[model samples]
Target chain A: MSRAGEGHRVTMREVAQRAGVSVTTVSHVVNHKTEARIGPEARERVRQAVEELGYRPNALAKTLVQGTSPFIGLVADSIASTPFAGQIVHGAQEEAWRHGHVLLVTNTEGNQEAEERAIAMMLQYNVRGILYSRWYHREVEVPPALGETDSVLVNCYGRVGAGPAAVVPDEVDGGRRAAEILLRRGHRRIAFINTTTASPARSGRLQGYRQALAGAGIPVDEDLILEARPDQEGGYGIADDLLATGATGVCCHNDRMAMGLYDTIKERGLSIPQDLSVVGFDNQEVIAGHLHPSLSTVALPHYEMGAAGVRVLLGLQEVPAGGILTVPCPPVERDSVDGAAAPPTG
Target chain B: MSRAGEGHRVTMREVAQRAGVSVTTVSHVVNHKTEARIGPEARERVRQAVEELGYRPNALAKTLVQGTSPFIGLVADSIASTPFAGQIVHGAQEEAWRHGHVLLVTNTEGNQEAEERAIAMMLQYNVRGILYSRWYHREVEVPPALGETDSVLVNCYGRVGAGPAAVVPDEVDGGRRAAEILLRRGHRRIAFINTTTASPARSGRLQGYRQALAGAGIPVDEDLILEARPDQEGGYGIADDLLATGATGVCCHNDRMAMGLYDTIKERGLSIPQDLSVVGFDNQEVIAGHLHPSLSTVALPHYEMGAAGVRVLLGLQEVPAGGILTVPCPPVERDSVDGAAAPPTG
Candidate 1:
């Protein structure tokens, strides 16, 4: 772990001396060379010492000697365009780099054919693992050939059961966080606007909302929920419908839909957090900041989700064999939500 | 070039016969493997026949057999939370796919050390080429060891004296487009609000504005141009400065700054395209559609820039070594601009 020009770092020689092994032997063990013929007892000693000293072998030097890679093949469904997809990539890259692995990204537009092509490209380069990124939470038909490789699906929980591990955000928790924020502001009559009921993100979020409401001794009213796309127009369309139902607060599935709702509220001659308080998800910065009143949203732990995905793929985390890991969601308060201050009694 | 399970597509065998070569030889050439001992005349003849027949080799079958990859490594500075970066990535991915190549992405966060690591990872994985994406147009210190590989820098150009090919949006053209859009709408006193003159994008854009004014026979007014960062508050500050000078139009470096301008304009009791006209660059979608008036911006031709970058790296296009290729910019006019009808009669 000692850098040539740096001080206050442990040297490989330290591990070698502690493990009672030659420097070359220590190097071989450190590099994880399968061909290294060290005795089991010596290997055990070196492993213990390496673990104790928290030694991280130089990936560059080791890769040069091995003529191969310690890199993970991360073919995102989309990198530049999709916020959710990009966040997953950021997380995976961070985790991979932290664990001495580098992530190679491919932007596939979530097409099965494109996904296969990306996977084949990864295989050609002998990438150690694969991470498939989807635009949102949905059933992704895992590429059949990925069984031989270690992979972690991001955002979407893949349906290919035994192929690769996956990391997905807790939409339910996101919904709950949204509800919690509204309830804490001493408001009830909350409405939910979702793009579609068939979507996992929407359904899971609804479940969290209902759970939160029930926990707070409030009735789960189906009449208050409005299904719509997570876009400005969709939210706008639903906003009037919800306002008609006499709801004072609303939680849109994601930020885009919330933006539409903001317009809807404004056009209806209603002031945010006054006539109707609003809470959105997926704290997208551009949309959040520019929206006249600024949007209050549930900040999905996208970065952490990405790091978790890579960690699971590297077998560094105890993710289940065929299960989804739901990351927690935290609420971000902005001007969108209103305080339900009592009217003057005069 | 044969596609199985489809009705009579031109087979590779036919191409071989037309060129007087074996099927295997045709396959080898199509797969980018020139290792075989084939005569130059025969190779040229085969190439002509394939071109004449418009043969598209089955990338999947070729990859399966020869293990040849068409994966280009995309090293983006970071797309985790940035909107513009994502657009560049989307554009690159689209173009890469058109060229029958998949892009692998790595976020380096503008860290040279991370860039080196990502490059080393790409090399270890044997990527065909590299597309280094930067957040801004500036001279970045490329990894010294990148000499062994071919690369194309995106959004940013390369070194003055040396290094990889590059394809960036024509900042001057974008600036000109913005200027013309505002002018066409009858905005005479236009103000240019930029982050800093030191920024290549800002400087290039300013040059474009000057060029446009010269074309229009309008005098260049230094008082109208103000330097500020491409952030919300910066735009607001610039807007405040521009309004004090009685400028009716504002052109910002990017959309984020433009958003700030909107806030400042609102605070000053000015209506967009009425009291003041505002146009922005980057065409960031979040602010484009969601903003009240919807920001008018100069489209950066992200798709063309990305595709052109791939073309440059794969030698699909003839661009000069150590030179910048500017992609054309077009104005997307929205609610932000209003035609300046005949001036009111005294």
Candidate 2:
């Protein structure tokens, strides 16, 4: 193989020279332009020269001529948001690779003009389609530039009746499964510590909590549904209130919150499961997997959402316009929650 | 002023029609090809039409005509390796965008053929350069294909005298600062908990610890330096041994190790800063920031390393061949370490 000098790429002319053919003939053979007849021996020589020189033909040029490109664009509000963004990117990348496409990811960091510029860049690059995503689940307006491409939303939804297909985690289902984990462990007086942030998750998870209690034939206790800041400190801040409810087990808004509860409880001479079995949401691997006793939690299905978005964008899957597709949030069981915690003292 | 249907980008012909000019004139105006002698009136009309139509000219096409691209390629072993990948991507993205280049990131996940294919894709796309990175700091072989373009390594280095310039964290400095943090807090009998992993961090940090202690006029106690698996459980397992050293303060290999120590110490009826001051490395935001008292520790300088990598790759910074640029790991002060921890009773 030939090695190019610094700041150089082997050109088609190099291949033509090595192949003993005109540059135009080399181009036609390499591009497979059927009408541009080339002798068999010359075509063979061109192929050998290409392999030897490690010559890479311009995919952009081919895209212009053939009207397609093996590229997908992922435009996210922020890719630096840990755990969430990484998994989503991984899922989409794997799926796109399977379909012989590469992903061009650009993080806009929620800046309006940056988002538009990123979208414009994708179009200019001749991306097959765009995956408009968020690091968190939320409702968003479809950027007008997105209308020029086949697009799908991942981990977020477009406003009702005003956007393309989307794939988001089943938030309510995630909540119900978390509650069920504790309910099955014989904890009736369960509390749901929800985030104070007003988003789909705040409401959806709460509704699921209610459904779980109702399904278990336990009377709903409005006071048991507590609100916190949805972080470790928030969970710590609400610890006294959460413990005062006399719940045997609690479902935290997230792993961070669960971590906080763990600290206060331990300080209070309490132990997880023995005194209070706990479950958390967003099985963020770093926190959930490393916590003392580890955390049993529900995952947001970020990977699935990313993969599904690509499928929809590439026409491998079909969804009606304005229809929001949902993927299940799988429950991960670990050491934090258990089935044999004795009922709270009468 | 106009939105194309799905998969349709506004073409030069459309702009020409809207401006009442020929397509050739519109192309020339958008391409900024000064050699074309289009009249000012026609150029002005084309510009107005482009703005009104929300037209995005093909950057790839322009690259073909002008011999340059406004894109940088970043191929990492894995971008989904939380915390590390995200920050590196953020830093590189910001630097590239500042230079009018968009980043096309791909995760090869250490597959050799995939790496080759990714490099080929970048070449075909006419990328201005490539920023090859690893989520973790280590030595790597520069792929043969990388010789064909401008490239820089981030958080990793190539074999001696064999590849592009690199930016890596100053692991030795990170370790020394972590020990100094505890030493400045009036803790003389300090222990160092090092990871068992054989890497730059393990050896470099131990050297730093020795330097800090020596600088304090204290003799190095080899017995006080212990090794573990570089995780929370490892710290927990080594607590008895760590406690046996009569060290009032300790510097952990990383944040996860510090987390483990927190659990075991509290379980043994002890408190941080009150009984045993603690310092950790990595400063992983999720674990370090949310830990009970919040961890005071050293950072890995992932962000700065990433930004520096881009600067060097773009020729904005000069680095001698095979020189590994080191970014300082700044110490973050938090509540975990303090000067008031009572000396261990003899």
In model 1, which runs have C-alpha deviations exceeding 4 angstroms? Answer: A1-69, A159-164, A264-270, A289-292, A320-322, A342-346, B1-71, B90-102, B124-129, B237-239, B263-270, B341-346
Best by TM-score: 2
User: What DockQ does candidate 2 have relative to the true complex?
Assistant: 0.74
Q: Pick the candidate with the highest lDDT.
A: 2
Which of the CAPRI classes, incorrect, acceptable, medium or high, describes model 2? medium
**Residue lDDT tens for model 1, B40-90:** 888898899877665555443444344444667888886877756766777
Put down candidate 1 lDDT per residue, A1-346, tens digits, no spaces.
3222211223578789889999888888877777979898999999988776645454434453564556688777766566667777787887888888767677766566777777766655556677776767777777754653567777776655554667778888888989888888887788888767477887789999999999899997888888886677678677557866677778888888887776556555567767777888988867776566778889877788788878877778887555778788888888877775432110
For model 2 the local lDDT of residue B181 reads: 96
Cα lDDT, model 1, residue B329: 85
Candidate 2 lDDT by residue in tens digits, B198-294: 8888888899999999999999988899999888988888888888888899999999999998998998888887888989998887889888889
Considering summed lDDT, which 10 consecutive residues are worst modelled in model 2 chain A?
A337-346
